[model samples]
Target: MTLPWETLTGEPRTVELYLTTPAGLALSRSMFNSAVWKPAIRATGIPDDRHNGMHVLRHTYASVLLDAGESIKALSAYLGHADPGFTLRTYTHLLPASEDRTRRAIDKALSEDQAGDDVPPSLDGLDTA
Candidate 1:
């Protein structure tokens, strides 16, 4: 469940926490107040007043997934959502672009398909005049 640091960053660092330092006793709080989080918050233009750890990252991840055409059901599963409806409601705004893209793709596919070209018009015998 742990990611290999070497894969993302070549910097050598240990993941283990020893209780010797104040940070080691409460890792979440320490990390939330750390320099890394502070800089990341500034860089991302996110308010630093949020103290709920890196939950903004979770929101961003969900938004990104939804933006990438991932279905709400799939995103719910990936995020361990308690209910698919919750995921849908929470990420509704993030889905419109993806939905539009999908709609366009389907329309494009249908337009390019030659299979329907041979079908005679159903109203051919009906004259509007």
Candidate 2:
């Protein structure tokens, strides 16, 4: 579909807008690179390379959300992945270590039976003396 555009030399042109702004406005490729993306990448102090493009941002997006404890099913839908299993496979390394999950699970289960600051009840079969 043809979209409106302006040339660097002030000529009006017809073109397709590729990247869009967060506010939903269509941005031509040049406009997006000059006005938005280039500045953001420069701010990060990393030299711009052909390999460091929008897909890098997408990967970082997934990494940050996974680190924040977002569920695979929810992240999958947010990322428009067809299957949650794919999301898990792609981002499993970003999840917290199993030890963290185990600790949280024990803490949560015990806290529900007490005021959270109380000492956990000792398992009857374990002797700690």
Best-fitting candidate, scored by lDDT: 2
Candidate number achieving the greatest TM-score relative to the actual structure: 2
Error of 1 at 110 (Å): 3.6
Q: What's the TM-score of every candidate structure?
A: 0.50, 0.52
lDDT of 2 by residue, 13-74 (tens): 66554667776577666677778787888899868775676666777889888888888899
- Where is the poorest 10-residue window by lDDT in model 2? 1-10
Once fitted onto the true fold, the runs of candidate 2 whose alpha carbons sit more than 4 angstroms away are 1-25, 28-35, 39-45, 107-129
Candidate 1: TM-score?
0.50
Over 2-41, each residue of candidate 1 has an lDDT whose tens digit, in order, gives 3446457555565655432364453565655575667777
